[model samples]
Structures are given as C-alpha cells and as structure tokens.
Target: MRNAVLLPNGFVLTTDNSAGIGEKEADLVHVSDEVVAYFATRVALMEQWAAGAHPISIVLHNFSGNKNWDKYVEGIKKLFGEIAQPCPEITGSTESNMETLQSAIAVTLIGKQKTDSAEKYTWYVYGKPCVGQEVMTESDKIADLKKIWESIKSGLVESVWPVGSTGIAEECKRLGLRCELQGWDIVKSAGPATTVLLGIAKNRIEEAKLHFGKYFEEIN
Candidate 1:
C-alpha cells in the first residue's frame, strides 16, 4: 500500500522508508546511515513540498545504532539549514535492543497548506533524477535549489508531486497527467523523490524558467 495519507484539515502527511539498498547490491556504493537518513527525509519532504504544505514536524523510525542515530539527525538538520527552511520539531525512537543485519529508517513529514482555495494547475517536470545520484550532486548547487524553493514558496508553483520509487510515468499516471516528455526519459525510478512534478499555469511558464532553468521539463 502507498504510505501517504491526506487529512481533512487540508493537511497532507507522507511517510517514506529506506532499506540498506546500497549495502545489499554489489553494483551500488555502500552509503552511510546518514545518507540513507537524508534520503528518507527528502522523500517525505518532496511529497509535502509538492502538495504546497509547510513541513511542521518530523517523526523518524531508526533501526541503526547510536552512531547512525546522530548522523541521521544531522542529515535532517543539514537540509533544513541549507534550504533555509525552519527545522520542524523532530522526535523518534531507535530500535536499540534489537539487532538487524542491514540499516533501515523510515521518516514521516507532517504539514499543512493553510489555504482553502481549490485550483487545478498545469504540470511540469522539475529536475530529472539520475536515480538517487543527481539528488546528491545537484543538491550541492545550493543556489539552484534555493531558487526552486523560493519560487514554490512565492506561489509561482501551484502544486507539486514528487516522483517516487515507481518512476515518472507511474507518478504521472497516478495524478492523471499525460506525458509529452523530452530531454529526459520518463520511466526511470526517482528513488526517494530526487525530482518533482511541478504544477503551474501556462502563463507562468516564463516566470518559472527564471527559477528552474535547465531543471524544468514541460510535459504536454
């Protein structure tokens, strides 16, 4: 079953989980627990962010040890700091007594949009995800991300739908959107929501370009 739930108070809550994907695969790099934690955080945050919700709290489910615990918390804080987003009240428990073979974590982001207007919008793909790699490399370009968030915060973006593990085609299908993809393939797994499906009006396209630049890919 899907992990996201919508509340009656115009609030949307989404949860995302991460397993020791890297450790299990020889082809993949063995990512640290901190990186895994950040992946979980980003996955949840992307859902909430796309829905025009301001993240108000974080609830973590940690399976790693004390060392991984601190790194996990740091990853959460680091992103908020980088984006200039207020750090939400964070609280969760670690499964210390039990021992597991691989690291795992699940994070849920709670947020509300605080508005009553119900409006439909034109959709665009924002930032292509090269699996999970681009999320890390592109995130390092702080200015680009900041601009995207600034645009979203200012209402230029009507809504957002972060691409999930199922890939862009599935995500678009989930939202009942048709695809006219270009520059990037549409059926690749985003893996923890490293990219988004952006919603805006046709008239606002130029304005969005100023913020998104190469990150924006229109789907007609």
Candidate 2:
C-alpha cells in the first residue's frame, strides 16, 4: 500500500523511484537504464497487486533520456513476463531537452479492483530487506511476485503491504499493529519492495508457511 487512491472504477496505485545509480557520467551508481526501470516498475506493480487489483494502464515518467525509453519499457515488460501477465498500455515522456546528473523514473498503474471482501487475518513477512547494490547481490532474497500473486488468487493472502524505504515497523504502525520484529532489521528499508507484508487467515498460516518456505516469518 505505497499510494493508492479509491476511484469509482477501482484503486489507482502510483509509485516512483529515483536513483543516482545509472549509466551516466554524472551518476553515482553505474547501472543500466533497464535495471532502473525494472525496479521502478516493480514497486508500482507490487502496490497494484497487493491491493487486489489488476492493472489496465501504465504511465511512465522517464527523466533519464530518450535513448533509454525502449530499454526502460523492456525492463517493465520483463517484470510482467515474470508474473505471466501481459504488459498494459503505456504512455509517458522523456526528459530529452535537459540533461540530468542522475537517473530517475516514475511509474503509475491504474487497476480495477478484483475483490472487496473483508476478513480477519494474521500478518507475516516474506523476504528480506535489500537496497542499492544489495538488491542485485541479494536478489535471491527478494520475494517471488508470481508466487505471491498465486497465493492471493487462491485466497491464502487476504491483503498485502509492500515494504518500502520506511521499512516494516512503519508499515506495521500504519496497519495499527505493534512491531514485533527484533533489532534494526525491523527498521531497515526494503528497497523497491524486496519484502512484503502479507495478511493471511489464521487457518491458512501453515499453508502459507509451506508456500513461502524459508522466506516466511510471523510478524508476532
């Protein structure tokens, strides 16, 4: 639940990530445009899916350059492929006229709500927090989006909260739950939602544990 707005049709989820990490002479982190876009889109898509909605359209804000547009879109498409879903309609602009020292991108996903049921659930976390270079080095720890989607579709997951720069404790506060995780790990940022908070039915806890394997951890 990064940023979602309720609309007559559905929830509009919007998320953006800007990094000084890119293949630019002035950039701090030397990464390709594709990698930047992939993570940026990942955050937005995670928010949409977590809210039980399927995206219908996408809006991209590319501050990198015009030359990076296709690569950025390819990065977005790659994420969709990972989830076995088609990329939605995309529209956006590039900052061609001005040169920026850092790589920045924003993504907005418009989705139609798929479920409206209310149920009591126990919360848990899947995946470990990773940021910056750690995101690529510790990619294996990132939560599997496809599996999460399946769990949600199967009704094992009642709701989801993607962890962001604010980390798990802040997200827990927003959900009105006391943070039960110990140490600094509970407060460290989960960049680009590498970790997620899942609300599962009490009876389905075991099933979810099996579904998530070593990545699963109870919040309380």
Candidate 3:
C-alpha cells in the first residue's frame, strides 16, 4: 500500500530513517546529519509526488540533538530545490533533553490530490535496488527525483511507487500485479527507495523509455 494516510481534506505522507547511519558516536555509517535527513525526506517526498499530491507542509522529528536542526532543514530544502519546487512550511521538534548515540529522523508531508479519477497504466521499474552503504556508493544507480517529477507533470507517468525495504517483488504484489520482474533482485531491499516503480500511460511508454533511458526497465 502507499505510505500515506488519506484524510478528508488531503493525504499525509510520512517516512523515517534511523540507526547507526549518521555522524553520531554510535552511528556506523559515518554520514553527515544532513545526508541522513535528505534520504529520509526523499522517501516521503517521493510518496507524496507519486500520488499526484501537492505538498503544503512538512513536519520533522529530529533525534540527533538541537545542533543538527538547521542541517536537517537544509536537507529538506535541497530535495525540494532538485525538483524545482519551493520548500513547504516546516515545523518539528528536537530531542534536546537526552543525548542519543544514533541519528534518527522522520518527515511528514501534507499534500492535496488534484484528481479523483483513476486510469489504467503499464508498470515499469526505474533505477536499481540499493540499500545501506550502497545508497551512498552506488548513488548513480538511484532514480532521479527531478526527472520523475517532470514526467508525472508532463502526463508521461500516471502513478509512481518508490520501492522500499520490502523490495520490488513485494511492492508489485502490493500493487496487485501477478507478473514477475525478470533480471532483477526482486527480494533485495531498496533502502530509502533507491528504485522507483513507475505506472506509465500506455501511449507514453516509448516516450518514458526515451526520457529515462537506461534507468527504465519494463516489468514482464
């Protein structure tokens, strides 16, 4: 299912990342607080935009102390800039009372959907599945958020599902697809949604293939 809650007014998309992946003393990955927040926010933003929702606000949950607050906000803004969209209003809290060893953060995006009508489309995968340290080292294989956003706006893509830790096969199952995705490690975790599942309009299949080039692969 989509990682969003449908409210009477709009959808609330939320995602979080934690563990020893930050710059904290206990973090095993040794990445900056900003990088950690960026990928975490990327998951939520992709979920919001994939559902054709316009983001209105953002809520951040910071557990890496007060000093990292501004860095987290900067990361959120950077993601929005990549999509050429203005950063939405952001408000959240930081865990200042206690010193946490690992870096942890969560992001919530409030967005409004533009249409209610549903359309049938073909499914495709964009980018390779990468998790953990691969997220940083094999970053080039990750899907381009900017390109995906533009394709959706241009009517080339009808819907999108960012593959998470559940992997590609499970996500397809969640979508109710019966076919197997050949030539891919369908069970590998796509940490922070390094890969994206695109629902393309039948007529725009070729166009999307051309637009995404080698990153696009048909799900058979």
Question: How many backbone overlaps does candidate 1 show?
Answer: 1
lDDT of 2 by residue, 1-220 (tens): 5587767766566667766877888887777888888888888877887677878999889898888889889988988898888899899899999988778788888888886458889999888999888999999998888888888878999988899999989998998888787533988999989999999988899999999887678888
**Clash number for every model?**
1, 0, 0
| Candidate 3 overall lDDT versus native | 0.84
Which lDDT tens digits does candidate 3 get at residues 1-220? 3877777766656556666778788777888777888898899878876677868989998888899899989988998899998999999899999999788888888888777337778999998999888988998999998899899888888888899999989888888886466678989999998999988999888889899987678887
TM-score of each: 0.85, 0.93, 0.94
Go through the candidates in order and give each one's C-alpha lDDT: 0.72, 0.84, 0.84
How far off is model 2, as Cα RMSD?
1.6
Ranking by TM-score: 3, 2, 1
Model 1, residue 84: distance off in Å is 0.4
Q: What's the CA error at residue 134 for candidate 2, in Å?
A: 0.6
Tens digits of per-residue lDDT for model 1 on 10-31? 7779888876543434324476
* Residue runs of model 1 more than 4 Å from their true location after superposition: 1-3, 21-29, 116-120, 132-145
Q: Which segments of candidate 2 are over 4 A away from where they belong?
A: 182-184
lDDT of 2 at 95: 91
Please tell me which predicted candidate would have the highest TM-score against the true structure: 3
Q: Is candidate 2 or candidate 3 better by TM-score?
A: 3
Better of 1 and 2 by lDDT: 2
